[model samples]
Target chain A: MAQKKNIKNRATSKPSSLVWIMLILLIMGEFFLYAWSRVQCTRMGYEITREENKYKNQMNMRNNLQIELSRLKSPKRISLIAKTRLGLIRPAPKQTVIIR
Target chain B: MKFDNHKQISRRAAIIGIMFAGLFIMIGIRVIFLQTVQGPWLSKKAANQYEKSVIIRGKRGIIFDAAHREMAVSIQATSLAAYPGRIKNKNEAARKLSNILKIRFKNLRRKLETGRSFVWLKRQATPRQVQAVKALNLKGIGFIPEFNRFYPNKTLGAQVLGFSGIDGRGLEGLEFYYNAYLKGSERKIRVLTDALGRQFDTGQTNANGLGGNNIILTIDGNIQYITETALEEAAKKYNAESGIAIVMAPATGAILAMAHYPFFNPNAFNSFSRDRWRNRSITDSFEPGSTMKIFSAAAALDSGICDPNTIFYCENGEYRIGRNIIHDTKPHGWLSVQQIIKVSSNIGTVKVAEKVGGRSLYNLFKKFGFGNKTGVDCPGESTGSLSFYNKWSNIDKGTISFGQGVSVSALQLTSAAAAIANDGILMKPYLVQAITDQNGRLIQNFSPQKIHQVISARTARDLKRIMETVMTEGGTGVLAALEGYTVCGKTGTAQKVSTHGGYSKDKYIASFLGFAPAKKPEIVILVILDEPKKEHYGGIVAGPAFKKIAHQTLQYLNFTPLRQKKHQRVLAENEVSG
Candidate 1:
């Protein structure tokens, strides 16, 4: 009878310790996952910030280039280039032809 | 022995338990203290590490011409700043920056030696200079983005568009006029930063409606260029002191071109004198001279006192009224009203003015927008001096009739001439056609506003017919005639008011005020040259410029020439027959 009682107590104690181990493992896994996700969020934030800066720089470059294009396409400059470089002149009123 | 061992073990256990309980109590108290006392302070300190509230400014507004061509723009430019205390090798850094920035080493060293937390090394540095400095990788050096105003057209319409200051505030011209609307707003935003002190994109950057509203002007860039070129050529050819030219759409009073010479680039406005910064067409007034004869004739016709054929004695080129002799350019016999204007006879105009009487002429001048602001959307518009008719002396009547005693601005003259072209209805002149937001959403749209009818349509037609004779042979404005287009114009040569309280002998303001396709005028142009040296006659000095501007502008506007229209009609008829 004494031997049987001792075996039954051992069996109950094994399940309780096993359950405690599993609970602790689950809690630790959740904690690590939360920490890892925070780190990834910070990394993505840095990346987004870098991309935004790049976008702003590109926009500025586009604006500058547009301004340069406008300057190049200035009527005065074009007229000068046409006259001096291309050997062009404004047509006389009589030389002009209107289709409509 | 066994009982004594048990008692000792129990005692040790009690001591260990008490020690652990006391440690737990201390930890609990510390937690409470931190949560209650240091919580707010710690949170703030933590926030300071990773978050900051900063003020970001929007970009200044852009200025576009009628065709949406950028006249003025603001571009992103970088400025260099330094933290004086943080620089490790001040002399080396300053030397490197001096070469790239074109600054003196000593001056840069002095600036870096200052015990300031922050100092500006250069504002609005060129991109090449910025890149060169960046390559140096000097410590304690940082860059800040700022807006710098740029005029791509340079001197094309400088006096009209004006310029902004380094601080992005408009200082002159339309820039100054619409400063409030052109300057961007400021916003305070919270930004998140990383451990390395770099900002993270919070997506709130574009949330603020920060950019200033853009202004669209009625000015045509091509026409403005043509006008400026013509005015510059005329000024150079005549050796004139200065010149101003204005082009207006007769039907709407939209200012197509306001050109002035010698030209000054608004980009480097500071390098020029303050006098060159002024839009003299609106701000300066000069006597209209013979151009005023048109109005005097209009007054006479409108008042029913004289018809186009009414004959007036010219007094043989010189007439005396109260000891003041009014002389025509040449001797003239009795000429009709139209003949007087065609020849621009001052004596004949004076006689016509006498018939129209003083009060009637004064009312007519006032009706023509003389002595009043044209209400143009420009700064510092001068109200040309016009005294009441009751204050005129006998000589004043004669001189005023010949456009000597009266003064008018180029803008006012153009606007008044436009009235005649628009069939006697005066329209308010305007520069800014519309204001739009950054996204091009319309904020305001300006339209042509009619002031009132200054004369009957019949009177305007009669006046137009008489004015046309001025462009024909034997007319003062013969040079102003265009091929295949009827032109009605008047020439003006006024003796400038001298500093000694009388008219100067050597100085003259030669001017031409006219429009093309006289039967249905399309554009009204006024050209004035102050103190031309080569030629003083208004017909010779200003007429060619008027013709050039009119010809180029009308062609650009796609107005079919009369001969071209006829040829096209013949071609269409031939096609139909085939």
Candidate 2:
């Protein structure tokens, strides 16, 4: 009976060792892939933020120009200059055109 | 022999077994290092790599006039730029962008093809331009939201309102003066985003956003518009070198409307000349001329030296002192202090000054805010030239009494007259009344400040009565009269002295200073037309301009005619008489 028990223990040991090796390989592969993807994600976030800041600065420059244009075109200011410097008067009723 | 055969004790089997054992041992060592020695380092690295981050942006503030009308504000707009690294076809992208953005194709191609990874496609593109380009669906092009300030009432009070900078900071005027209160704090926000540039489903708000403060001026927009319009008309018609018109609230010393010629639109500061930027009201000085007579008379009256009924021989519009004979525009034989002001007689004023004496006259002018700064919120102001009474010769005092040998700004003249209107009390002139926070809370309020009481109410009342006679039929301001309204005013036709060449024959500064409704005044207007070529008389050049502005303002304010409603009694009597 002692001889039979010894043979049975030897029989189970080999496959168990093989099974543990395979599990170890699988875990390492998954870990490497997860680390690689994490690096890529971080890079992408940096790129997006850099781009966003650039866009904001560009927008700021544009808005400043628009404000200047609107202010220059304001009627109250231009009309005064016209009347004072250029000797232009408001258009009389006969001078205006009403088109349909 | 039996154990070796059953176990298959081959060399290959032994080698494989040893290798597997070594691999397991390596993993065990690594696990020990990770869980014990290097765990904190690995955890920090992971946090840095994977933690979500976000940035917060702040919006700028808006500017408003005295009446809480929008003078300037930051508005949201879309700006276009390109990601050159992402473009599939550079040539195609350039063509498409040029068509939609209305930019030159060659320029677009050159900019896009630059080695830089990104470039600006356009800035501050119109909404139509934005839509057209976005509809093209170019892969490399993108837009972002930004704000720019908008001045709605441009150039209305250009000098007084001043201007701002690109980062929404105030550069000049009230904008620079109250910038700290206008610009709000900057805030930062943390956000999460996906690889495709999509934000998280929900984002959090940043508590501290860049905000600016709100400003309230003392300017009435309607009145300013009117004053500016009439002044422009007069300046052009008379071929004057430069012009200025100012209206003030006498009791509070608040400048209602102050307009300067050769003015600039602060929005386009870069496009204008520096001359246009000069705010002459506080920045320049001119001879006060006959306007100084009112202050001189105030001094004489306040000293109890001259009464209103006091008479003086005019020498028939010409008086000689030390070989200097001052001539009047019109001649008068014998005149009281009231008629002297009405005719704007230089000789009469000289005689009054002679009786009033130099020391007393100088003191009176000093008390009415001359020979010193009014402490206005503007950047530059001259105290004006009022020589010390002891410093002046007898002839100098006499010339000063008739409004020569002294200089003052349009603002100084107005402020002094304001004291007269405010019952001899001088108030500090201010343009900005208050500054409010973004939430519409009143952060500050400016009260009506009286700097000094220069004269007694009785003297002021008497001065007002005399100044009013000058606006009636007997006065210089007959032209300043509004239709069917009793007006009070004084005119100054000052001689222009050339710095190098002594005095110019044709150059004269014609100015009018006055208030409305001879009995109870509502508004005070001052018009100064400098070096008017076509017209030389103050009544002819400046009087009508003041009249138009005051009349329109009173009509707009719905101020009743000076004469009470005798029409009601007349109508009732007519019905009974009939």
Candidate 3:
């Protein structure tokens, strides 16, 4: 009878040790996942900042180019070029034709 | 002895247990105190380590012309700043920056060596300079983004658009008037920084709404350019002290062009004199000279006191009133009002003024918007002087009748002429057409406003006919006549009020005020030249410019010549007959 009791006790000890090992593995996995997510969040933050800066720079460049285009299209400059470089003159009143 | 030893051991164990319990209780109380009493302060202190609050200013608004062409724009530029205490090897940094920035070495060095904790190295640095500085990667130097106002057309409409200062405050012109709407608002935002003091998060802030609302003006850029060119050429040709020209749409009262001579670039406004910075057309008033005859005739005709054919005996070149002798440029006999206006006879105008009476003429001038501000959107509008009829002596009435004693701004005269052109209805003049957001959404629209009618439609037509005679062969404004279009105009030559007291003998303000397509006038143009050296006659000096501007503007408006219209009508009639 005593030998039977000792066998039963050994069987219970084996299951408990297995359960302990499983719990420990599960905790380790959770820690690693939390750490990985944290690192990803930080990396994404840096990337977003870089992209925002690039977007701002591009917007500035567009504004500058638009201003430059306006300057180039100024009437004074166009008229000057037309008169001097292109050798053009404004048509007289009678020379111009109007389409109905 | 054994039992005694057992009791002693029990006592010692119990005392040590109590001591350990007391120590734990103290620790618990301390924790509670820290959590309750100083939690918020500690949390804030921790946040300061990696978080910052920064103030951001929105970009200033843009100014667009009638056709949506950019007149003034704001662009992002980098400003260089320095921490004097953090800078090492200041001499080398200053030397390098001086070369790149085109600043004097001594000045740059002095700025760098200042005792202040922070100082501006340069404001609104060029892109090339910023690039050179960044390439150097010098310590303690940093760049701040700022908006710089740029006038793309330079001097095209400088006096109208005005300019803003470095701090983004408007100091003159429409800029000064609309500064509140053009200036951006300030916003505060929180940002997260990393250990290296680099921003990692921009935080939750919508910055787009903070920018100023953009302005759209009624000024036509092409028309403004044409007017400025013509005015400059005319002023230079005549060697006048200054000049002003205004173009207005008769029906809408939209000022298409307001040009001032001696132009200055708003981009470099500081380099020009303050005198040149003024929009003289709106700010300064001058005698309209004989141009006032058109209004006088309108007054006489509108009051039904005199018709276009009312014969007034012009004193054959000179007429006496009280103590003053009013002389016509040339002798005139018993001339009808039409002929009198054609020749710009001063005596005839005075006689018409006499029949209309001082009170009636004053009321007419007031009705034409001579003595009050037109309430134009531009800054610094002058209410041209028109003394009360109660204060007018006989001489004042005669002089005022021919535009000698009274004064009128270029804008007021243009608007009054526009009233006549619009067939007796006076429309309030305006420059700004609308206000828009950054995304091109309409915020507000300025529509045309009509003031009271100054004359009856029939009288306005008769007055237009009499005025058209001024552009005929014997008229004083004969030079201002367009080849294919009928022009209604008046010429004015008023002697300037001499500094000593009376009118100057040689100095004169010669002007031409007129409109084209007399039957349905589309545009009214007023051109004035102050102190012309070449000639003092209004027709000789200012009539040609009036003609050029009127012709070009009418052509631009796509008005077909009367002769062409007639030919086209004839062709259509023949086609119908077939």
Best DockQ goes to which candidate? 3
Report the error of model 1 at residue B207, Å.
Answer: 6.6
Clash count per candidate:
0, 7, 0
lDDT of 1: 0.92
TM-score of chain B of each: 0.94, 0.86, 0.94
**lDDT, ranked from best to worst:** 1, 3, 2
Looking at model 3, residue B282 earns an lDDT score of 93
Model 1 clash tally, residue pairs: 0
Candidate 3 collision pairs: none
| DockQ, computed on Cα atoms, for candidate 2 | 0.09
User: Every model's DockQ, to 2 decimals?
Assistant: 0.71, 0.09, 0.73
TM-score of each: 0.95, 0.77, 0.95
Candidate 2 lDDT over residue span B258-303, tens digit each: 9887567776787987777767888788886888788878877888
With a 3 Å backbone cut-off (N, CA, C), the pairs that clash in candidate 1 are none
Docking class of 1: medium
lDDT of 1 at B286: 88
Candidate 2, residue B505: the lDDT equals 81
- State the iRMSD of every prediction, in order shown: 1.1, 9.4, 1.2
Computed on alpha carbons, the lDDT of every model, listed in order, comes to: 0.92, 0.79, 0.91
